[model samples]
Target chain A: MPLNITLTDYGVGNLYSIRRSLENCGAEVTVVRDMKEVLDAECVVFPGVGAFDKTMEKLQPYREDIREKLLSGTPALGICIGMQIMYNSSAEGTTPGLGVFDGDVVPLVGKVIPHMGWNQVVSDDPLMDGVGDRNFYFAHSFRGNPSEDITIGTTEYEGTEIPTFFRKANTYGTQFHPEKSSTSGMAVLRNFISFAESVL
Target chain B: MLTKRIIPCLDVKDGKVVKGINFKGLRDVGYPPELAAAYEKQGADEITFLDITASLETRQTMLDIVSETAGKLFVPLTVGGGIRSVSDMRDALNAGADKVSVNSAAVKDPSIISECAESFGRQCVVVAIDGKRVDDHWEVFTHGGTKPTGIDAVEWAKKAEDLGAGEILLTSMDADGVKTGYDIPLTAAVADEVSIPVIASGGCGSKEHIYDVFAQTNASAALAASIFHYNECTVGEVKEYLRDRGIVVR
Candidate 1:
């Protein structure tokens, strides 16, 4: 059966584009704003934008439900701000995070803020194919410093080796929005969906 | 090592691709996504779409085109032409544009560059300086090279970098459609002033011009419109030519 992917539409994300892209790749997608709709899906995507504190506040009501879903081996993929919230603490917000990963979101210092545009990803996984040593689209200021075991790929800027993608069993996250990453980004979504389905 | 980039800049009108010479005789270039895919297949380093016709009616359509092309190209994409506010930048970035270039908008408010860089990161922000020789000094142009800003081109390029711009896309309005060659002096001037990468746009007619630009100027990359559009020079051919000239390109 095709994976039932729920892209949480918490009034923060540009979910339409992400949903449409996943649907095009033959995945069953549902745009959800409520916890009831979320539980019906096997794979959950926490795609968000804006301040980390604000995002965490908005997700507060559903945090317990999300935690429950994740601990049950339901795959959860976070994008951008969503990924930052997975870490223990984020400099962007005074409030704490979900503490799913042992890391913190820190600001890009000295160099320009909001490390936008495209940069090269140092990857050794199927999620990043055909990208080679080229550039992938990025738009963020704070980045996750994942523990060694969770980091899957990285992108460097000014000397900072930021973990671009992180994976720990059923929980996966990308500081860069793969949905917005052009073609190579699509391949990542495909990989995540496949990874979720094979979870036994 | 950094690879040479082949970029195709589309002049967009009401969300459709349009092209012309010397910013005149506007002609249709078909769908933006189709043109982007063609360029990507030809091994383009990136694609830039500029909404030439800056109008309220065209804004939504341009966003749609940006979203659509971003999906098909699968490489770095930059959108420009009518960006004004952070909201505009957000709209374009959300639509899948990897980077958004601001020309006229940045001139009106110099801090917009830093503001955008702060929100989206410096790498996502590009300051496109349209330069033209005015009385022996290169001056920045606004409104698609229709009006000239009093600021000196070289000075402005450095200021843009200082303001947190990740890269500079310098276009010589005088050489834009001339197809003679790049303004090596102006390119070198800006490239010399800034530590960041400079993309040399305008006045590229042949592979030799690319070699000359790289060999003569410190430009990180060379960008041409008509030459690449008309198949006058392919990126591989240009790179191979540059390589023979002892310029490092990957």
Candidate 2:
């Protein structure tokens, strides 16, 4: 049986890659434009695209409901800005985040503003099972800074360790776009599918 | 550590990938999605579609190609050429482009850079500078690299960054397609002048040329067309060559 995934489309950036990638991974993906649909999802995917505040444009109203659902272990996946919104707030935007995690999303301290391009990830989690030592593509200036306990993966850049992956309960958020990270990234998505299948 | 990138550029015209000699005498190669997918499998860090279509009538064809290709790419897809305004950028991004590159439109009015950056986060805005060495410094060229804007390439790069450009696609007209190597001094000057990452373009005939650009300059990535188009070398082969020479590539 295919795992039913509800992908949120808050009308920010393109969701083609994420939608296509999830479908290719053998999941029945449904992109819901209305933010409220996220609450009732069997499995939810919050894609990382667009500005932080603007990304919260639609979800701001239902922030509490969505947070409650996710915290109750609703099988949620957030990427980049999607992950940022799960925090209390972000330096990128003035709007308040969903507070799924107990920390704030902050700007990365580095010479290069946006840590663009591929970088190595260090994690022994199940998602990294077949990912091995392959690097993942990243393109963002800000990242979530929740406590180290929730951070399952970290990627070093210019001597600073940037948290790239977070997992708490049944929810997971990634700073890097697994959909755009090519084959190794696909491996992570595949693992997530298997995870959702097992959990379901 | 962030690994250096190798991007394969697909110059498309009228819906097909085309190869040419110094941006002229174009020849059709293949479909954009088909070619881009192959490059992705070959370990290309990213794929770029440089739409060289000449008329307004054919621009939609390129956008259609972008939509088709972007739907399949697992890697970041950047589209360039013929993009003029924020509306044009909207069309491309809405059609599924991750980032859009503006050239002549930006050189004519720098405000477009900030506007586009404002409209769609700066990370999605890329300013492409076609440069040619004259006397001691390089001058910016527009209109398909046929007309020189008399703007200093180094200064323009800095201004673009200041205006909120996320990255600079520096193409050296003097060394373009010559295959000797990237114009190291020119690339180094601009890269050093700007803090934002720069992608070195043109004059990449061999893997050694790829090595020279990365080893000598601070460019975050290097783009090539002919070398990978003619099967002279694959993105995988170049990466292997770079990896063997103690340079990190993805």
Candidate 3:
């Protein structure tokens, strides 16, 4: 049987790429609109790129529930703004995040603002295992600023290294858009599903 | 270090990819999905779909094409041409575009850039500026490079950055179909003025042209059409040339 992945849809941006990418990786994807249903999933995925406040609008109220589920060893993957909301606050918007991790989302330090394009990742974590190029597609101006040593991956931009992937138990967060990141990105989704299956 | 990007642009007219010479004399090539997939396989860092016939009537067709192509494309997909307002940007984004490139409309109302940045994130907003060299300075052009705006190319790039455009797609009108190489001086001026990543468009015939832009200026990506669409060389082959010449590519 295929592993069922519950994708949260708060109606901010297109959920097609991530949903379709997950399906391509051999998972039975179900995009759940309700916060209550999101908690009762085989695996959870917070995957998209949108404004922080707009994305956290419908998801803000259930912060405690989402955090609790993630903390209780739920295998989850967060990408871009999806990963940003795992922090305490974001400089991008006024809305408060779920605060799953002790951090804030701040602007990426560089001469260039968004740092849009492909960049090599520095990580030896199992999550990055088997990625052919080790280079992931990144298109964001801000990244998660974790307070502790939960950093699993880092990418360099103009002599500055930003913590891109943060890990806490079975939950993982990455600032890159894996779905739009070509084949190496597919390796990430494939690895995530396998990791989700093991934990579930 | 962040690797320089190599992008292949596909001009779509009513859902099918087309080829044209300097924005004139068009010809049908292939569907968006297959060509995009082929380029992606060839290690294209990103793919752009320019709606040459981006009229109000064919707007829905472009959106549908974006939806169809994005479903099968793995790398970042940028859709340009015909994005006049936030609603248009929203439609393209909702239809699965990773980024929306705004041209002529942005010149009329600069606030459109900020609005789109506010509605979506700045990362999804790309400002495409078409410029041509005239006398001693480059001039910004709109309406498919037919109508000339008195805006200075360098100043407009800086203004677009100030107005919250994430990236700039700087295309040189003088070099569109010439394909000798990218307009190095024109590209260098805007890219040096903007703090955001700039993708140099137009005037690329060989892999050497891509290398020239990256080595000659701060342009982050190089966008081409006829060179790659005609199968002169694959994007993978271009990367090999860049890598061998000491430029890092993913």
lDDT of 2 by residue, B11-44 (tens): 8888877784232123424777878888898899
Clashing pairs in 3: none
lDDT measured at residue B1 in model 2 versus the true structure, 0 to 100: 88
Which of candidates 1 and 2 reaches a greater TM-score? 2
DockQ of predicted model 3: 0.84
Top candidate by DockQ: 3
Could you give candidate 3's per-residue lDDT for residues A61-174 as a string of tens digits?
788898888888989988988899988899988999988888899888889888788888889999889898788889888889999888999998898888888888788898
Shift in Å, residue B43, candidate 2: 0.5
Over A106-190, each residue of candidate 2 has an lDDT whose tens digit, in order, gives 8887777678899998888898898856699898888888964799999999988878899987889999989999999899999
- Across all candidates, the chain A TM-score values are 0.89, 0.97, 0.97
Write candidate 1's Cα lDDT for B1-250 as tens digits.
2345557677888766566423212243477787777776665667888888878788999999887876666566788878899889889888878778999989989999999877765767889999999897899998889997899999998899889887899999988888899999899998888876788998888888888888898776777767666666665677678768787554
Where does candidate 3 stray beyond 4 Å? B20-29
Interface Cα RMSD, each model: 5.1, 1.0, 0.9
CA lDDT of each prediction against the hidden true structure: 0.75, 0.88, 0.88
Each candidate's clash count:
8, 0, 0
> What DockQ results for candidate 2?
0.79
